[model samples]
Target: MLYFVYTADRPGSSALREELVEAHWAYMDGFEFHARGPTLSDDGETATGSLHIVDLPSDGAARAFVTEEPNWRAGVYAAMQIFRFEDLVGRTMWEFPGPEGERFLVTGAAGEPVGDGVIVHGRLRGLDDGAVHGFAACVQAPDADAAARTVRDGRDLTVRPWCFGGRR
Candidate 1:
């Protein structure tokens, strides 16, 4: 079974999050079923949440995975959702092709029709800012037109992919 673990950071808890970053990674590294995941964002620089898509042997395993996370244990997370997902598409962010130094900010809505083709064309795999989903990705195309062409359909939400410092 594939599980989508959405976690939101607690307000004013940046200090606690910083303190637990290493421990959080360490805990995630210990997971046996983790697959694709990413830190959620809003502006791209500051992290606001996280998304973990993992394959587990059973519901019990999924439950255990969350209970053992460092942020949950330390109270740095304010909200989260565990969804049993289906028909998941899209590759992991780590697999997205781009220069090693290339990084950009992405903000948009959750794909449409939940179970339908939500997994359309896009390399982003996380959410930023609680209001709208945001993420950082290695844009496959140099421009939006080229990126849109890669999707199953040529239509998609605008992926204002901007470099870290600011728009070029």
Candidate 2:
């Protein structure tokens, strides 16, 4: 099963996040990830949240993965969401033919998946109902405005700058 796991950090957990960064990576190293990154503050210095599309064995496993995450365990996360995700882009972020520009995570409303500068795109579905509820995508463009326009046609759309996260 695939899942979209995302989190919003507590108001002032930056230090805790920094302290657990290594542990976070160590834990994530065990997962099969389609995409992973930290959503950031507009200026790009502070991490606001995290986003990852992972392939796991079951819903229970996915939930456990989220709860056991280093950040979650350390109480750095304020809010979190896990969804049954359908990976529309079948490749990892490392293989993305990303355009030259900033990266943004655009989410809200489901529609036809676009290509171009897509790093990873997927359908966000209800965990229990299994019905697609929205769209989540990582895209590269000149700016957030361009990235938002890139994934045209959506409701409640939001664009957040996403800082690359992986063993690079």
Q: Candidates' lDDT values, in order?
A: 0.49, 0.87
Model 2 lDDT tens row, 1-168 = 889999999999999999999999999999888889899999988999999888999889989999999899999999999999888878888888755568999998855547588888888988888998899888888888888877767678889999679674
Candidate 2 local lDDT, residue 20: 96
User: 102-166, model 1: which lDDT tens digit per residue?
Assistant: 23222233332222212222223322222323222224344454443333332234444333210
Task: Tell me how candidate 1 scores on lDDT.
Answer: 0.49
- Candidate 2 ranges beyond 4 A from true positions: 113-115
Candidate topping TM-score: 2
Each model's TM-score, in the order given?
A: 0.56, 0.95
| Native-to-model Cα distance after best TM-score fit, residue 159 in candidate 2, in Å | 0.6
